[model samples]
Target: MFGEYRTLSAKPGYSYTYTDGWTLSANPVYSYTYTDGWVYHGRSRYSCESVIRIILAETSLRSTVQREDALNNKIRAAKKLADIDSNSSQLRQLKQLEKELEKLKKTRADQVRTLYEWECMLRVGSLRRGYISVKSNPAWYLREELVEDCISRGGCCSRDCGCCERRRLSAKNGKGIGHCTLECMCCIHDQGSEFTAEEKKDFNGRFGKMLRSNNPAFLLRITNAYFSKPLFWKIKTKHK
Candidate 1:
């Protein structure tokens, strides 16, 4: 019996019986075990089924969660676009604000350019007169008799007559003013002095040359700029 039991235990799918003190235990070759002819051990098929089911449940839950997240992302994007479209007034206001900002920027740039031009002109005028000993203020120069009488009263050459408003009104009926009428009028009014005889001759020669040049615009430019003031006097002479 012992030999048969050992042979059965070694077989691939065979059952055996072992007895001890009147107790009999069956050993299953595929699924059961008997230890010391008393204890029986076997495994149930449902033991692995729970673990397999748990893995499948986890995989299914993860797939569902992924699908839900994708759907939510698409919905969020669509809602954002719809909200933008619905706020038409806000969009128009934003565009208007941009235009206003651009206009303000352009206005600021123009102001800066205008200030720069004024600064340039002032600097240029200062440099032109810097080295010259005599400086003429534009306002006083405008009111000067040499400039004003040359434009309004033609000329004056009397040695004792004043060139002020009262003297001019009083002398309007006198004989034609002299050659140095402008100078005499200035001197009589205590405003200027007489030029020397040599200076007078030199002025006549220079003025005659300029007139004979026959460049219409050149004379006009000189007249407008110098305006009866001596040609060489107006030119800024370097003192240093």
Candidate 2:
């Protein structure tokens, strides 16, 4: 039955052979087996947990850097604006922004120091003897309370009080009372006449102390301190 048997050698092997209308082929077939060493797919890789931790750390660092850069840019802008014109309407806003930036810088520095302390504590495997810390002095609360009382009794000429009538009158008459130089006494006296002698004495004692300690900037400082009282109290409570 080998009618067309032909021996065709190509590189010491036959490329194709036909015998009795049948075809025979010789080709290698590769196969793979699953083994313990083959589970890694021939690549070095980190564990899933490690990869997740790395990603989180990188994201946190990037966000922190961006926040710091934004704060710095805002500070620079405020400084530039403040320097451009002292009499501009935005002068107050620029000054306030500068003050806020300074506070933020101090806050950031404190946070970094606190973090370093905690890291050190963790490394040493010990706790601090007393972890309590004060964010603000207790004296600030007392001062704020005194200022609020004085303000309510018209010892300080708040905008909400009847003492504003004096300002309106002065403005109408074109006479500046120079309230800063006079310790705001002009407006206070105009409103104080309605209060009892005891009330007036108490107001005078507290207001006088404030004036003597900080003659020019007392009002501004007291106002800011009063407003910040709640924040200080919150921090104190957290520490406690």
Candidate 3:
């Protein structure tokens, strides 16, 4: 019956609600809840495999974007310096950047090709290998879409929410962009807690039950990525 519903295209920074209601934000980080709500589901094992592949793809994208941005910055600096002062160091740096840009051009092409291949594989492999494609994997795709949609929708919350919160919390705050993390934490925590009596009554009157999940394993796995921060420095020290 759920599958019978027509699939509607949604815009970035906006998710489709059951009715015509617009959710506050599309970012899954900010969105309190979303599940397929459809009866169809992927097997847990296959879902995990699909998620890992998606993660690999995502990591590659993040790494490439960072490198490209860094390269662009270097090129800009080199150009600026070349205009002002054509010193030996500046010339050498400019030449090195030219070489780096060539390398990155090749690298970008390869990555794009690889991603296209992965996209094809994900689409076709689902039937042959029983793995869901990114399009078919609703849960995984939801998170991925949320991030991109958030980034595309002005790359900040100030536009969506009335809070006008910026990336930096305070000048003295050592943890850059920690406010975002804190905001997410509080939002999730509050959602887990008591809502207003009217809200509770309304939800109960509608769904006849409080929303809750019995899956501790799933919770741990989702939050594990956040837990690795403390170990990063130690890991780097050991590697060095």
Candidate 4:
């Protein structure tokens, strides 16, 4: 089980995970300047604020992906059940769910395109007061709380189904192998219930609470880890 965050290292490109434990943050560091060729392209300039916003958007986009993904899996599970026990009401519900999922997929597509463009705009970027340097761990979301929370959300972690341990590369993540999201079909199938609007609001609150003003360092650390875009946090020599 992975531990929660611990102290941050002073190094510009690395963080400590308790060595056998964990924590996170970064100190003030150099910033970035766009290269001349980048300017020649007449692209809108990048800023530290812009980068932060992009990272936040990435987090939100992942939520969108997870929602749709969960719904998609639920549809599959529903279909299987419908096959076993045919019900016109169930079939109709499945159709409606499929429709909703398509809408979400379209929204996700739009976000993905916009995010890709923004990321390209600042693909070569950095921080003002610090840098993001999460190590290359094939498995992210190792924090014990994240997994435990998964069970709380009725994820498969609570059972021998082994879904949480499946080394999943969720549509919700780019490079991290992590626990189940609202998207775990096994959990939804077993529970026979979906997340309510209030619960989803609560989950969103908990998920993004770290970004509060009181914990800006954590914001950077999570941003770095989730987006897997540390190269953007690298310090660049003043672009000549």
Give the winner by lDDT: 4
- Per-residue error for 54 in candidate 4, Å, reads 3.5
Cα lDDT tens digits, model 3, 144-230, are 223333334333332353121322232112111221221232232434643465863564343212222332233222222221111
* TM-score: model 3 vs. ground truth: 0.39
Candidate 4 TM-score to native: 0.52
RMSD of 1: 56.7
Ranked by TM-score from best down, the candidates are 4, 3, 2, 1
Best by TM-score: 4
Using lDDT as the measure, name the better of candidate 2 and candidate 3: 3
lDDT, candidates in the order shown: 0.32, 0.34, 0.35, 0.50
Off by over 4 Å in 2: 1-68, 83-85, 123-240
RMSD, one per candidate, in order: 56.7, 33.7, 18.8, 11.0
**Candidate 1 lDDT by residue in tens digits, 130-239:** 21212232221223333433344333322223232233222212211112232342332354454576975676466545533433332323222321222224311112
Worst 10 residues of 3 by lDDT: 230-239
TM agreement with the true structure for every prediction = 0.20, 0.24, 0.39, 0.52
Positional deviation of 141 in candidate 2, in angstroms? 43
Ranking of predictions according to lDDT = 4, 3, 2, 1
